[model samples]
Target chain A: MTQESAARRFVVAAIALAAAAAALVGLTLLAGASPIDALHALAEGSVGSRAALGETLARATALVLTAIAASLAFRAGVLNIGLEGQFLAGAVAAAAVGPLLSGAPFVARAGLLVASALAGALWVLPAAYLEARRGVPEVLSTILLNLIAAAAVSGLVRGALQDPRGDYPQSRALPDAVRLAPLVSGSRATAAIVAAIALALLVTLVVEATPLGLKLRATGLAPAAARAIGLPGARLRLLAFSASGALAGLAGGLEVLAVTGRLYDPFSAGAGYTGIAAALLGGSHPLAAAASAMLFAALGAGSSAMQRDTGVPGALATIVPGVLVLTVLAARARLTQKRA
Target chain B: MSGFFAIALLLAAPLLLAATGELLLERAGSIQIGLEGTMLIGAFTAFAAARSGAGPHAALLAAACAGLLAGAAFAAFAVAGRADPILVGTAWNLVAAGGTAFSYRLLAGATGSVLEVKALPPFAFGLPAAALAAFFVPAVLEVFLTRTRPGLALVAAGDNPLALEATGGSVVAVRTAASVAAGALGALGGALLVLTVSPTFVEGVTAGRGFLALALVVFARWKPLRLVPGALLVGGATALQYRLQAGGGTGIPYAVFLALPGLLALFALAAARGRGGAPKALGTPAP
Candidate 1:
């Protein structure tokens, strides 16, 4: 982190941003629309009005939490790619419990979110066990878990968690009495976004200022050296892994409480994966990753509007994040190589 | 029973092809965790080509070409550029998924309609020629790895890249070449899916087949010929699930069948005993 390297990093970020912007414009042109119209629509849709800003914040709630989840694990040297599975597990938990609870709204909400977080942590146990005991790569096992989770969701919607009152393959909806209310009238933004921001700040403080954070970073940065010093590498990894799962699970629970009232098959639009992209773009810093997630949320909100207004295709939301990450990865690698 | 076996083999075709390609790439010491993305790229290329009036075989060819390019691009980042393969692959999935979806909407014009392309002509037992040919790929790979000089060089590169370098060979070159070939095979695997049984393109049409193929390689313990039984097992399980779904009133839950392949793959990894036969230099940066 010398000044020169920091300057280089800034340059890399600038170039990557420029490239992403150019790609967006190119894609808009390819769709036979004027780039100016697409940009106008994108800005207007993401931040132009109250409703649009609300949409962006609502989307940011999940992305911010998941981004923090990814950053936490990555910072600890554990590649917990099963965030997607854990997220679904949490959503399923919320969907299952939200319908059955009867109590004060605050108590019910707390109970449901806790259950969802525990479910998400539980979902990752198999991957963790396989990796530690059988030497199986968590990468493969977690991905397999994702597939299993997706299958389970598809089945539960039809059988176990099915909304018996309706023919659709979806779980029973959460009662509005138990769900979070909008922060503003005519907008989707909720208290969940505020909670997400608070958590991000807390995690940043812990990682950047605490002794426990040093131990985790030490384990991640140098396993052998940490082992020589008698640090509990495995325990730290497990802690990070579980905590990461809990964060993602919380995201899923909030999605249900704040946005979608019910869990359906394929409920997520790859929120976990997009969150990982945000973390990568932010270089895995908690606060930076949260900012990146918010940026992505804006992109998603704006792109859908662009698609509606200028026929630019909403998939740009997915593509632009990917391109930025790829550019960042290549640039970082090249710079490191030159320094070495 | 015979009908079940026929359908099972047909279903196993794509997995077998993709797994074989993965085995080759891994054997060369570079793993593309983004094989799913590669397959999606292939599926879309075939669909787009066929929709644009190419015949089935020509579409397959187009898909293979796209895969070759995809493989080379991946090598540019993960091999030549020495970036983390796993991270590169994770991003690759996003790019491929979003790229195909964007292109599909552009091509289909937001109609959200079902546009079917012509399927390949059946070869035997109601299987396409490509599907039947997919079963023999493992044996071919086995022979290639054991008997061919280039294949041995590929293996050498994977097992001991420094030694290969001492002997005046470029690990990057061998890996890049292997990646290109693997890319073709993986794409063909995807094309066979659309041109044989499915005959249509959807977002994520390959589903988790790419992942299943990755599992198959690990289950096979990096052995070329061992992939057949594993692929057939998954295929049979899937076929049985379909049969059970069609014949309602079975007491077994439908989710179990849907999860059978992934569950089986997970079990295989757990049972495989600590990367016993994995390539020594698998996922290592090319020298």
Candidate 2:
């Protein structure tokens, strides 16, 4: 927390940014495009116009929520890597329930969102039980759960949750009456982003200012010491894990109501994993993680535009965050070694 | 029944190869959860090699080389650099996935046509030579881990690094070497897939097989030879799923078939109980 340390951290961030930028430039050149043009395209696509900004904000909604979810679990000493699966579970819940409700738009929307959150929480039960009872690492179990969820989604779209009126392998679409409306004319931005931001702030307040937050951090920081002091580490972990899942689930539900409108195979574009990367980049601080998520959303939005404008591939959006994270990790390790 | 067994063995070959390599790496005390990325790198390398006029065997060699570099790069960051392996791996997957997709676009252009590559020729029992050799990997690993001096040294590095250090060993060196070898094997597993069953490359051609291989290692309780049965079980399930799908209809939900392998792995994890014979120094940085 000292000024010197803060300055050192700034230097590390600068180096990492530089490294990522260098990688971006190299990739752009490899794609036979000028780096300047790519950069220009990226900027214009992400924030140059109202539509681009709207796209960025819309994407940020889910990323922000999932980042908070990842931060919550990580800070509570739980490695809940099933956010991807949990997200899918939430989306499925929304799709399954959204079509069944009628008459009142508000009630139907609320019902769908609640169902999604519950589904997300329920999805993690098996991993939690296996870890608590059988001493299986939640890491492996949660990853396996992700695979299962994906497989289930692929199946549901074709079989159980398929749209009866359509020939495609996808669930019934949510009626427009119940879906989220754009916040402004001619842009895709919706209330989902506002809700995501509010939730991020709330999580920050709970984790930083509350007694529960202190206990969660204490357990994560030192499980043995916390246990010796009767801190109920297991209960805290379970609470954190479930709450995290709920947040991710809510994100998924919002995505259905705000953007996609229906569930299908490959519903997520790795939103959960990218969210985890954002949390890591932010050092697991809820607000910082939200900011990182927004940045990633912008990168994703702009990369597609860049691809359209230039010949460069939009996969750069995925690669850049990874490069940044790896650089940060290596820098942190080097700093720790130096201090040692 | 014989046809089913043959298909199951064919499907098991890639999983067995990847799992064997992973077992060796974990035994040497470092874990690369990014084996999925390594496999992708290998798969892409083979695809590119084949597209650029290399023979199937040469493409395999190229992929193995790419795997070596991927392994070394991972070790540089996670091992020698002393970074958190898990975080490194999480990011590694993104980079590999994105990098391969980016490169594939460059190679294939904006064309939406399917690009096919030459498959490895079948040897015995309608299996490619590489696929047949995959079955022998676990046995070789079993002997290497139990009967050899270096193998014992690797175990020492995993279980008791300080003791190994006292006896003039370097944990970093052993882990790095194991990582490189593991990378080559994992890549070969991926290349074998493209060269045998799926003779064309696509985005994510391995389709979570890398992760399934990781589960297989856990199912095997970190024992090399035990990986065979675990891989076979998952492979058999996949074979069945394919057969069921080909038949056009089934009494059971097809989703159940898709999820069968993961479901089985979860049961295996829960049933096995407690750390399940994981290496003592697993996931720990070299002292």
lDDT of 2 by residue, B147-238 (tens): 99999999998899999999999999999999999999999888888888789889888888888888888888899989998999999988
For each prediction in turn, the share of the native Cα contacts (below 8 Å between chains A and B) that it retains comes to: 0.63, 0.76
- In lDDT terms, how accurate is model 2? 0.90
CAPRI tier for the interface of model 1: medium
* Accuracy of chain B in candidate 2 (TM-score): 0.98
- Give the alpha carbon lDDT tens digit for every residue of B1-287 in model 1: 38899889988999999999999999999998888889989999999999999999999999999999999998898888887888888888889999999999999998998989999997788877889999999999999999999889999989999989999999999999988888888888888888876889999898888989998999999999999999999999888888888897788787787898889999999988657799999998876
lDDT of 2 by residue, A240-267 (tens): 9999999999999999999999999889
* Global lDDT of each candidate: 0.90, 0.90
- Candidate 1 residue-wise lDDT at B92: 88
- What's the true lDDT of residue B278 in model 2? 92
DockQ computed for model 2 against the true two-chain complex using alpha carbons: 0.81
Measured by DockQ, the strongest candidate is: 2
Query: Candidate 2 at A280: error in angstroms?
Result: 0.8
Evaluate model 1: give its TM-score: 0.98
